[model samples]
Target: MRVSAKSDYALRALIEMAGRTDGHPVSAEELGRQQNIPHGFLQSILADLRRASVVVSQRGQSGGWRMARPASDVSVADVIRAVDGPLVSVYGVRPEAVEYNDSAEVLQHVWIAARRSLRDVFENVSIQQLADGKLPAAVTSRTADEDAWQPH
Candidate 1:
């Protein structure tokens, strides 16, 4: 399944936050500049993230955005869901909600399995681990697979 640009940008912005050294808030403009995401798009993405409690925002001359919790507490899946809803969906419906008959019934299982596989990586990957450049063994193993990097 294709990941939408919203999910991609949210993840990139969060990853940029994960890499911050200073505790000061990061302005949306700076975040967009650093991550190469459009400023307007980043603002919308940040609004969703803030609503989800993934990132906190402040107001004032020195105010901007910062993580609501530590980087280790936030998973990539969390950010994706905040911006894009479910990690996997068939058409616009959730995998489990899709119905089919006879031979096509087995197709639901395929979608379920796809969601499971995606969760195994996205849920387990913390922003801290991403910032440290040390992915979990499961994620590392997948990356190590020669086929994983190949274009479909």
Candidate 2:
């Protein structure tokens, strides 16, 4: 599963806002500068987040974007879905939505497993964990897997 640049920027933007939740609203310009996201691109991404109810925007003097809910309640999955759709997908279809025949039937299990694996990581983690520089034990263990990067 690959996170797109848009999703990366959205995560970063969310992190920035998470850190400053009670401080003040953060402008897209500031978020872009801080996260190095393209300003125009950030606007569109922010708009998506806004529509998803993940982030709320304020207009005028002390205005910008802030998390609609507490950062602790937001998951990485939420941000990813808001910006990039599903956490895991195969051939543009959800794992549960696809059917297979004969030998290809095994691929359904593979897709379900892949989606399950991704959810294991993405769902257990909340935005506040990232914002606070902490990750869940399950999440960390997956990262620490000695085989995480080596070819089988």
Q: Highest lDDT among the candidates is held by which one?
A: 1
Residues 113-137 of candidate 2: C-alpha lDDT, one tens digit per residue:
9888888888888888989999999
Question: Which clashing pairs does model 2 show?
Answer: none
lDDT score for candidate 1 against the true structure: 0.91
Provide the overall lDDT of each model, using Cα atoms, as 2-decimal numbers.
0.91, 0.89
The TM-score values for the models, in the order shown, are 0.96, 0.93
lDDT of 1 by residue, 1-152 (tens): 77899988988888888898988899999999998999888899999999999999999999989999999999999989999999898888999999998989999999999999999999999988987888999889888989989998
Decoy 2 TM-score against native: 0.93
Could you tell me how far off, in angstroms, the CA of residue 151 lies in candidate 2 after the best superposition? 6.7
- Per-candidate RMSD, Å: 1.0, 1.5
Candidate 1: regions farther than 4 A off: none
lDDT of 2: 0.89
Highest TM-score model number: 1
